[model samples]
Target chain A: MRDQNRQFRLAKRPEGKPDHDTFDLVETDVPDPGPGEALVRTRYLSVDPYMRGRMSAGESYADPWEVGDPLRGGVVGEVVESNGAGFEAGDIVTGDLQWADYATAPGTALRAVDPDLGPVSTALGVLGMPGRTAYFGVREVAEPGPSDTFVVTGAAGAVGSVAGQIASLAGARVVGFAGSAEKVAFLEDELGFDAGIDYSATDDYGAALDEAAPDGVDAYFDNVGGPITDAVFDRLNVDARVAVCGQISLYNATERPTGPRKLPGLVSKRARVEGFLVGDFAPRFEAATERLAEWVASGDLQYRETVTEGLESAPDAFLGLFEGENVGKQLVRVSEPDE
Target chain B: MRDQNRQFRLAKRPEGKPDHDTFDLVETDVPDPGPGEALVRTRYLSVDPYMRGRMSAGESYADPWEVGDPLRGGVVGEVVESNGAGFEAGDIVTGDLQWADYATAPGTALRAVDPDLGPVSTALGVLGMPGRTAYFGVREVAEPGPSDTFVVTGAAGAVGSVAGQIASLAGARVVGFAGSAEKVAFLEDELGFDAGIDYSATDDYGAALDEAAPDGVDAYFDNVGGPITDAVFDRLNVDARVAVCGQISLYNATERPTGPRKLPGLVSKRARVEGFLVGDFAPRFEAATERLAEWVASGDLQYRETVTEGLESAPDAFLGLFEGENVGKQLVRVSEPDE
Candidate 1:
């Protein structure tokens, strides 16, 4: 085991889009596991769009990361050492941990990663937070009916891909908005999405929606916000439901971006727009994860991963989320699990 | 009995605010009652903000008025003649009727207005559409709890006045935003709102809210959806619920106005914003109206009205709504009931 650990720290609050200067990588002594704690070597670090919110000083669902504090997110790792905790050495686990090669966390915070659930790395993707988010967001919030037209933005991203598929499984006509033709192809050809629109190809999203969602959008899962959302709001059918899962488009905005007022439009449609966090459903995580695994095992659900090669690539991987550079779940591979 | 009927017809769609040119007053012979219909002499004409949406060429929850159609709205009238319909000659009734001295309609489309429910005009204000809007919006959509901090915009207006009081009755701290010091006094003094912000007194709604709703807003009932709503969105606490009741501010806008995006903020707060029309709760309207009437009868609720003396003033009364001219319900007294 390495005696030294490398971790990324928040260098400063970003003004807009985070650049290389926003993060500082430093070498430090590996944290020792205290009583009821475990020392885990990270195999895969989850790089998500939501992490960008933590880099700011403003209040959000998760507490902001202060300058010089180690950046933290979901990590799938192998436990190397345990101190009076319910875990054995070499056990695969996942928890909210520092963006580093190694992290020490209370054993109570960690969950055993079932290797049988596809790949161990999936503990950070399909069988994990993103998957559970899609499950609850679709079932509880969006509630797309069989005759409903379900529209999702960022169709190729981690949570959105699963959300569209889940809506499709519910017998709704699922339409997705993706940045590229390849992502559009993935949604329609692989995920069984009824239709897909390449938003990058047209500035007039309303026209694109007119073609893909001819009947108008009844349920919308918004992972990206901006003009795309404006267009969706314009075409909302009566009694529509919008689950605001993420706003990757506005995370790095230096100032609040102004858009056409939407609340007024809601009155005519009698629609609902709700924002939620997956952590709010932690109590049901186990049951939801099991359901997700069952789908994956049955070939009813599929997922792709864009893995960055090393821990040093974590910042780049995260920045790529805003750039639409990753196709599916963006993960930073820190190490390989022991055979 | 009057031999001539004076009616207002939509001459053309307004580009911004409707003016005298938009409506043409015409005098015509009163139509005889058809089978199963009654001839009703207009007594009171209800002028409301929602009417503005119907004047546009664009589609809305209510069907738009085509050019050259007689302007129609809520009206309280006395049945002069019944043709095998369920009404006596002297019965006071209310229904969607024309803005004319007399209108003939099937008795099935009209509801008898009980004079025992305060004055007959109350059927157009506190005991009518506006009151029922407040009832369902607060009880079903906003759902304020005992510990909640409720904020309402257009607090002295018809729907908002009742909404704030209902939230207060639910044991929530109610703060209201109104246009004038007098309206603020009506909200805080007469309606029992905990605090009132005169929006016309300051441009900084957020600063005013910081003082009035220091703990942050938990439930919001929005009637005037512009800067006032933007301020409330900024101060929303976690799990906030926003009930979008009306948007009088934007009813006359020739083009959509832009404002700071609010959905992104909903993510951090896990808030829900829903829009509703009172008509959507039609099945429950009778029960809801009874509850509202009970509140008014018990002196738990208070109401005000700004009545125009003549039907000739109907267009002006409606235009007044956009200017924040009415304190509570705005109505035009078209004729007097016989003793």
Candidate 2:
């Protein structure tokens, strides 16, 4: 075990879009844990769209990662050492353990990462927050009724891919929008989506959406909010429900993207659009994750992990989210499990 | 009675927006009704923004007015003679009377107009359908919880003007938006409103909206759907309810208006925007109207009527709705009450 920790901290606050200069990788002596805290050897790290929001200094869902402070998100690791806490050495646990080789945290935040349900690393993907997000949005927000059509953007992504499958399981007709032909094919062919549209080559999203969803949309689970979302608004059926989960497309934009008007549509159609943060449902999270884990075990839910091999590549993995490089959930392996 | 009935019919379907040439007025002999029908002598006529959509030869909430046929809408009149049906002579009623001197309607479509309810002319304005629209929207659609702030646009117009008063009676902080200073003052001084904004003088709507509704909007009753509507969206607090009743702002535009880009906000804010048609509430329309009439009689709900005297002036009265001419409700006086 190393006596030092390698940390990646926010070097400076990003004004608009972030680049390489915003992060600073630093090495420091590993500190001893206080009572009730355990030192964990991180093996996997979670990178998500929400972390980008935390990089800015202001009010956000997650506390902003201040300049010179180590960045933290969902991490799965075995406890190397503990200060008389419930966690023991060799016990695998998960929590927000930062972008570091080793992290010390209170025992309360840690959850036992059960490997038999699926790969332990999946605690950051299918069996974790992203999976729970898809569950809450599908079951709580949209709640697709009989023979309803569910439209999802970023259909081949972590939250979206899971959302489509769950929506289908709930007896809804599932359609997805993706940026590439390959993703569109993957979503439709491999994932059991009723329909998929390649938004990359489609210039007129309104017409393409019309062709894809001829009957009009009943519920929209939006991951990318821009013109594509506006196009969906134009074709929304009366009394439709919209779950605004993420705006990955607009997160990095220098200014707010301007698109076709929506207030009239909101009034004329009497449809509903709502935003949600997954963490709000954290109290009932285990209930969602347990079902997701069971679904994956029963083959009712399938997930693809876009894995980056090493902890050193975590920055690249984080940046890839904005570029849409991830097919499903994106995670980085900090260390190999003892075989 | 004259044998010839003067009728205003659709001359041509408007491809974009309506013009003078789109409507044609003609003279024809009044047609006699068959069984279960009553011949209605048109006395008062309704000219509203919703009629513009009925003029188009396409699918909408209401059926389109066919070319060479008499245009039809809500008409208040007396039953001169009943064709072996329920209606009797001197029976004041409201029904789908065409834009002509006399109309033949099935007994199912007609309702006896109560002469004791203020002015029978008010059946065409406040204390009537528009008033009912306000009552139901505030009580049902935009159900403002206590401490909720209700914001309305096109605040001086019929539906919105009434909505503000009803919201205030329901113990909501009412803020309104209108085109002119005089109208804004009327909303604040004469009508019961917490705040009023003159949209014409305010160059930056977002800032002005933020100023007026600094605490944030909890409910929005939208009558106009343009830039002003967009501004309301940005100022909405989390979990806000938006009742989109009408979009008079876009009624005359040749193309769809370009304004606020809101799907992103919808996603981030978790708000619900729903569209509704008053006709859909048929199961409870009488219940709503009864309560509204009671409120008006109690002097709890006040109203204004922009009466354009004579059926020949009905076209100009309707056109006046888009121009913000009607203070409360715009109607045409087809006959003198004593006549």
Candidate 3:
């Protein structure tokens, strides 16, 4: 194992879309686990679209990443050294940590992952934050009833993909809006989505949405916000529920983009729109994880991952999320775990 | 009583704002009530901002008024003649009826109003649709908790005045945004609002709102939608509730206006925004009326009305609502009932 740890730091705030200059990869002495801490060898580091928000000097869900600070995110790792109780060497764990080859964290922050629960990496994808986000957002926020038409933007993405499946399980007709034809096919053919619209190929989103949701959208799970969300708002049925999970489309915008006013329609339809975070559902995480695992075990839920091999590729992997290069969760594999 | 019924008919749809030409006052011979119907001599006719929507060719909460058809609205009248079982001549009743001195309605549509409920006109003001709208909107939709900083726009208007009072009664710190200093004084002095901002005098709404709500806005009742709403959205606390009762500010917009995007804030704060109509609370209207009456009886609730004296002034009264000419509920007193 390398004696030096390599990590990416926010070098500067980006005006819009971030590039290589936004990050600076630095090497340092491998961190040591202090009392009640564990030294983790990161096997996978999550590269999410939300990370883009932290790279800007603006208000976001999380505090902005200060220039010269190492970036942080969800990391699935194996404990190499420990000075804490309940955690031993070779234990596989997951927690929010630095995007580095190795990270040291409080043992309490790291939750042990059972490899037998179908691949430890699933802890960062379908069995983790993204999965729980989909579960709570769809089941609680959107509340799609049977025979309802559910439309989800960013449908081929981690949270959106899972959200669509949850809507389908609830006996609703699920429709998805994805960026590419391959992603659209993945949603319709592999995931049992009733219909999938390739937003990249469609000029008239309103017309495409009308064709997909002929009866009107009963629930909308919005993972991306822009013109697509505007169209969905226009097609909402009376009492329609909208769950605003993310606005990845605007994360990289230089300025706030205004669109058609939506409040008028909400009043006429008596509809509801809400925004939520996964951290808010921490108390119910165990329940959601159990259900998601069962779905995955029964082949009722499926997931895809786009991974780049090495800590050096983490920046590119994260930037690729904006370019629609990822179908599901984007992660960077720093090393292979011990079998 | 007059032998001919005079009513306003939709002459044509207005391009932007309806003018005198938009209405044609037509006269016809008064007809006798059929079996199970009552001939109601109109006393007070409601001319509200929502009536402006029916005159347009766009979709709204209610159906559009067709060309050459008499406009209909809430009318408090005396049963001049009854061919119905439950109603007697001279019975005071209120129902949705044509804007005329006299019109016939099914007895079932007319609800008998007690003259003892602090003036029967209170049925059209504090004891009526506007009152019930504020009741359900504050209690159910916004759900303001005690000690919450509640902010309401169009705060001196009919529904807003009541909504602010309801929030104050719920033990919240109420702040109001009104169009004039007199209206602001009405909210702060008579209605017990903690603070009132005359939006017309303020150039920076965000700064004004911040000064009023030093902590943050926990609940927002939006009766007017425009730049003022955009500013309140910026100061929303975590888990804030927004009740969108009306968008009177946008009722006469010639074109759809685009404002700053607000969905991104929802994800971080986990806020909820819902639109509602008073009709949605029909099942519990009796309970709301009782509570509202108790409040008014206790002198804890107060209201004001800008009454236009004749039925011929109904069009101008409604148009005045859009112009911010009326302070509270705008009603035309068509006639006085025989004591």
TM-score of each: 0.99, 0.94, 0.99
Candidate ordering by TM-score (highest first): 3, 1, 2
Q: Which regions of candidate 1 fall more than 4 Å away from where they truly are?
A: none
Clash count for each candidate, listed in order shown: 0, 9, 0
How is the predicted docking of candidate 3 categorized under the CAPRI scheme? high
For residues A1-339, what per-residue lDDT tens digits would candidate 2 score against the true structure? 777788889999887778788788888877677899998888989999888888977545567887999988899999888887698899999998879888899999899888888889889888998999999988888777767889999889999999999999998989999879999989988789999988888879889878778889999999898888888888888788888898888777667677766755665466777778787788999889899998899888989999898777888899888888989999988887672
| Per-residue alpha-carbon lDDT of candidate 1 for residues B1-339, written as tens digits (9 for 90 to 100) | 888889999989999988888888899899899999999999999988888889887888899999999999999999999997799899999999999999999999999998898899999999999999999999999999999999989899989999999998999999999999999998888999999999999999999999999999999999888888999999999999999988888888898888999999998899999999898999998998899889999999999999998778988988888889999999999998752
Candidate 2's DockQ is 0.52
Alpha-carbon DockQ of candidate 1 = 0.90
Candidate 2 per-residue C-alpha lDDT over B60-158 given as tens digits, one digit per residue, 9 for 90 to 100 = 567777788788878998887788769898898887779888888887888888889877877766766777778778788887766989999888888
| Best-to-worst lDDT order | 1, 3, 2
Chain B structural similarity as TM-score, candidate 3: 0.98
Question: Which window of ten consecutive residues has the lowest lDDT sum in model 2 chain A?
Answer: A261-270
What value does the lDDT take at residue A50 in candidate 1?
A: 87
Docking level for model 1: high
